[model samples]
Target chain A: MRSTVMYGAGDVRVENLPDPKLEQPTDALVRVVRACVCGSDLHPYHSMPAAEQGTQMGHEFIGVVEEVGSEVSLISRGDFVIAPFAYFDNTCEFCREGLTTSCEHGGFFSTAQSEAVRVPLADGTLVKAPVGDDSALLPSLLTLSDVLITGHHAAVMGQVGPGTSVTVIGDGAVGLLAVLAAKRLGAEQIVLMGRHQARTNLGREFGATDVVAERGEEGIAKVLELTGGKGTRAVLECVGYMNAYEMAIGTVRSGGIISRVGVPQYEEAPIGMGSLFGRNVRLAGGPGAQRSYIEELLPDVLEGRIEPGKVFDRTVALDATPEGYTAMDERTALKVLVRP
Target chain B: MRSTVMYGAGDVRVENLPDPKLEQPTDALVRVVRACVCGSDLHPYHSMPAAEQGTQMGHEFIGVVEEVGSEVSLISRGDFVIAPFAYFDNTCEFCREGLTTSCEHGGFFSTAQSEAVRVPLADGTLVKAPVGDDSALLPSLLTLSDVLITGHHAAVMGQVGPGTSVTVIGDGAVGLLAVLAAKRLGAEQIVLMGRHQARTNLGREFGATDVVAERGEEGIAKVLELTGGKGTRAVLECVGYMNAYEMAIGTVRSGGIISRVGVPQYEEAPIGMGSLFGRNVRLAGGPGAQRSYIEELLPDVLEGRIEPGKVFDRTVALDATPEGYTAMDERTALKVLVRP
Candidate 1:
C-alpha cells in the first residue's frame, strides 16, 4: 500500500507503506476509491508542530469494503461506502444525540489516506450506498466525509430555512458547499465573502446570491446593507481567523444565528459577550456530524439534483497526491480529488 | 420634580431638578411609585467613566402615568404601568421581531431613581396593569421592569423548559430571579451558584433544587456531577464577569444553552471557542428584552402565583438614595427598593 506523508512543512510525499489491517473486532478494511486533501490538513502542512513523524495524511474518502472483522455485520466485502473524517461508536449517548464527532470513544481516520485502510467501529461508522457500477460521484461523495457535511452542519445550526438570508464567511469548498446547503434549506439569499474566482463562481453555481470581496468592516457593512440594515438572519463562518469571527458577528442581525464551522487557529477570538448579548445573536455550530447529512444528500448528488462535484476544480491520480496538496495550498484548486 | 443624579462615583443625590416637560411627541410624564438600584448602575458608581458627565441614575421603575403627549394614546393619565428599562417604538421591525430593547429608537429611562420622570414612546413602551390597586405587588412588578424580565429573557434565550436542568451563574437579584423564571418554566432541577444567604434563600424558595456555594472550577464540577457528568441543559449567566462566563461555559452540556445577562465588563474575556464548538453548546443570551416578558409574567405576580419582590430585602425613601446604593454595594442588602 502507498500513502502520502509530510516530513516537514511543504514536504508532501507519496510512498509505499505497510497495508492497514484490522486491529479490533469492530474494524473493517476498505480499499480507498477516492480521497482528497482537506483545509485542516493544510494547517499542519504549513506549520511544523502538528506534523508528526510518519503521520499519514487525509481524513475524507469513499471506498469499497476489502475485508471485514468478525464483529462487523453491517459492512461486508464489496460494499461501497462513505467514511466520515471522525469515527464514533453510534450507540453512545453523544452519538444518539447526533454529536458523533464528540463521541466518548471517537477517533479520527487520517491514516485512511493510503490505498487500503482500517476503519474502526465499521458497522456504525460506514454508510453503505446501494448503487453498483456507479463511482463517478465519488469525489462529491467523498466530500460528504467532511467538507459537505460541515457546510450543511453550519447551515443547520444557524437554522437556515425559508425566507432566511445567510452570509457564508469563507470561500473554501466547505464555504461554497454551505451556500448549497443554505439554498437547499430554502434560504432566500446567500452571500459569499471571498476573492477566489474559481470557488466564487462555484459558490454562485451552488446558490450564493451575492459576493463581497471586501474584508472586515467593509465586508460586514455590505452584508448589512444587503440585508436591508438588519443584517442576515443566519451567518456561516467557515474561516477560524479572528477577523473572520468578528465579521460574522458584525454581519449577523440582532437575534440572528452565527453557525461557525471554522477550527480556531488562534487561541482567542473577538466574540464580545456584551455585544453578542446586546445584539441577541445566537452562536450555534460545531464540527459537522457528516453522517447526519450524507445519507440524505448522497441521493441528491446521485440524481444530479446538486452539482457539488463542480467544487473539485482539479483531479489527480493517486501517485499525484502531493500535487493535490500543493494545488490546494497555493489556492490553485478549491478541491483536488484523487482517484486510485 | 425630583431626580436622582450621580454627582460622583459614591454620591447619589435626590434633589429638585427642573420638571421634565415633554420634548418629543412620543414622550409622557410619569410619577414614579417605586424604583431600584440596578447592577449596571453600580458600574458607573464604582468607577465613573471620565465622559459620564452628571448623568441621571437608575433605569428600572414602576410608575403611574401622570401626563401623556398628544402622540401617546394607548397610555393615559392615572394608568399604573410597568415602564421597561428602555422605551421603544413597538412598530419598528426590530420590535416586531420581539427585540424591543434593540429597537432603532429605543431610549432608556433616565432619572428613574426619582419622583417624576419622562418616558419616551410612552404608548408602546409602557404596559398597564389591569388592577389600579396592586401596590402590594409593586416591588415584584418593579422587578419586572428590569430584573425579573431580564431573568426571564435569560431563561427564554437559553431555551429552558420542562425537564431541563438549569444552572444560574449569579447571585444578584437578576440571578435569583432567573431561578424563579426557570422554576416557572418547569425546569426539573435548578442549581444556583451564589453564596449570599438572602439570594440562596430566595433561590431555594423559588424552587432551586440545589445551591452551589463554590465559585469557579469547584462550582462547575458540582454542576457537571449533578447532571451525571453531562452538565446542565440550560445555564443562565447572571454575573457579567470573566469568571462567570468561564463557569457558564464549563457547566453546560453538549447542545446546552448558556443565556448570559451579565453586562460584559471586560473587553477581552478569553472565551474558549474550541470548547464551545467541540461540545456543540448553544450560546444564546444578551441584555434581556425585559419589555417582551413583563406582560405575561405580571399577571402571575398580581395573582401572587410568584413573589419576585422577596429578593428585595431592604427599602429606603427616595431621599436616602445614596444609602440604598451603599447598602447594595456593601452587600448589606440583596436588593433595595426606593419609594419616591
Candidate 2:
C-alpha cells in the first residue's frame, strides 16, 4: 500500500507501506476511497517538531470496509463508510451525551492517507454511506468525516437558529461551511469576516448576508456598525488564533454566544470579567463530535440540500499528496481532496 | 435627612443631608425603609483612596415612595417599592430581552444608604411591594434588590434546573442564596464550597446537599469525587477571585456551565484552550439583571415561600452605620442591615 508520511516541516512523502489488517476484536480494515488535507493538518506540516522517522498523516477519510473483526456489528465488509476524524466507542457515557469527541475510549485516525487503514471501535466509528459507490458524492461524504460536521458543530454550539444573526470569523474551508451551516439552521443574517475577495465571494455564495474585509479592531467596529452597534447574536469563531478569539468575543452582542471549532493555539487567553461577565457572552465548542453529527447531516448531502464538498477546490492522485500540502500552504487552493 | 458616607478606607460616617427632590419627570423621591451593606460595598470600604470629601455608599435598599414626578407611572407616592441594585429604563431593547443590567439608560445605586433618595427612571426601576408596611418581610424584600436576585441570576445563567447537580463556590450571603435559588429551580444536588462551618451550616439550611471545605486542587478533586469523576452540570461562581474562577472551571463537566455573579476583581484570568475548549465548558453571568428578576421573585418573598433576608446576621441604626461595615469586615456578620 502507498501512504503519505510527514518527515518534518515542509517534508511530505508518498511511500509504499505494509497494508493494515484488523487487530482488535472491534477493529476493521478499510480501503481508502477518498481523503482530504485538513486545515489542522497544516499546523503540524508547518512547525511540528522534527522527528527521527516519518509519521503517518491524515485523519479525514471515507473508505470501504475490506474486513471486520468478530466484534464489529454496525458495519460489514464491502460497505462504504465515513470514518469520523476520531474513533469512539459510542456507547460510553460521554458518547451517550453527544460528546463523542471526549469519549472514554477514543483515538484519532492514524495512517489514514493511505490505500488501507485499521479502524478501531469499528461499530461506533463507521457510518455507512447512504448511497453505494457514488463517486460524485465522495467529496461531500469525505467532508462529513471532519470539516462539514465541524462547521455544523460550531453552528450548533453558537446556538444559531431561525431569525438570529450570526458572525463567522475566518475564510478557510470550515468557516465557509459554517456560513452554510448557519444558513441551513435558518439564521436570518450571516456575516462572514474574511479579508480575501475570492474567499469572501465563496462565502457569499454559501449564504453570507454581509462581508467585513477588515481585521482586528477595524473588523469588530465594522461588524458592530453593520449590526446597529449591538453585534451579532451568535459568533462562529472558526479561527483559533488569539486575535480571532478576541474578535469573536468583541463582535457578539451583550447576551450573544461565541462558538469555537478551530483548534485553539493559545495557552493563556485573557477572559476578563468586565468583558465576558458584563456582556453575558457564552463560549463553547471544541473538536466536533463528528460521529454524532455525521448521521444527522448525511441525508442533507445525499439529497443535495447542502453542497459543503465544494470547499474542495482541488483534487489529486495519491502520489501527488505532497503538492496538496504546498498548494494549501501557499494559499493557492482552499482544500485538496485525495483519491487513493 | 441622614446618610452613610465613605470618607476613606475604614472611615464611614452618618451625616445630615438635604432632602432629595424629583429632578426628572420620570424620577421619584423615596424615603428609605431599609438598606444593607453588600460584600461589594466592602471592596471600597476596605481600601478606598483618601479624598477631599466623602462618597455616598450603598446599592441595596427598600423604601416608601414619598413623591413622584409627573412621568412616574409604575410607582407612586406612598407605595412601598424595592429599588433594584441598578436602575434602568425598562423599555430599552436590552431590558426587553431580560438584561436590565445592560440597559441603554442604566445606573448603579449611589447615596442609597440615606433617609431619602432621588430615584431616576422610577417607572422601570421600582417594583411596588405586594404588601404595605410588612416590617417582618423587609429583610427578604430588600434582598430582591440585589443579593437574592443576583443568586437567582447565577442559577439561571448556569442553566440549572430539575435533576441537574450544581456546585455553589462561595459561602457568603450571595452563595447561600445561590443554594436557595438552585433548590428552588429544582436542582437535585447542591454542593456548597466553603471553609467556615457557620457559613456552610447556613448553606445546608439553604439546601446545600454537600459542603466541601477544601480549596484549589483538593477542592476540585473532592467535587470530582462527589460527582463520580464527571463533575457537576452547573457551577455557581459566587467568589470573584482567580482561584474561585479556576475552581469553577475545573469543577464543571464537559459541556457544563459556570455562572458567575461575583464582581470579578482580576484584570487577567487565564482561560487556556486546554481547559475551556477541550472540555467544552461554558462561562456565563455578570452583574445580575436585578430589575428583570425582582418582579418574578418578589411574589415568593412576599408570600413567605423564601426567606433570603435571614442572611443578615446583624442590624444597626443609621448613626451606627460604621459598625455595620466593621461587623462584616471582621467576619462577625454574614450581612448587616441598616435602618435609617
Best by lDDT: 2
**DockQ values, each candidate:** 0.60, 0.65
Residue B152's lDDT within candidate 1 is 93
lDDT of 1 by residue, A1-340 (tens): 9888878878888889888888999999999888888888888888855345757788888889989999999889999988988898888988887888878888888875679789999987999986653567766777788888999999999999998989999999889999999999999889999988777888998899999988989998888888888889899999877888889888898889989898877655555654576788888887876567887888888887887777787889888988998998989888888766
Instruction: Kindly list the interface RMSD, in angstroms, of each predicted candidate in the order they appear.
Output: 2.2, 1.6
- What is the TM-score (0 to 1) of chain A in model 2? 0.98
Cα-based lDDT at residue B217, candidate 2? 98
Instruction: Please provide TM-scores, in order, for all candidate models, with all chains considered together.
Output: 0.97, 0.97
Question: Model 2: runs farther than 4 Å from truth?
Answer: none
lDDT (Cα, tens digit) per residue for candidate 2, span B16-92: 98888878999999989999999988889877998879998988899999999998777878999999988899999
How far is B229's C-alpha from truth in model 1 (Å)? 1.6
Q: lDDT score, residue A189, model 2?
A: 89
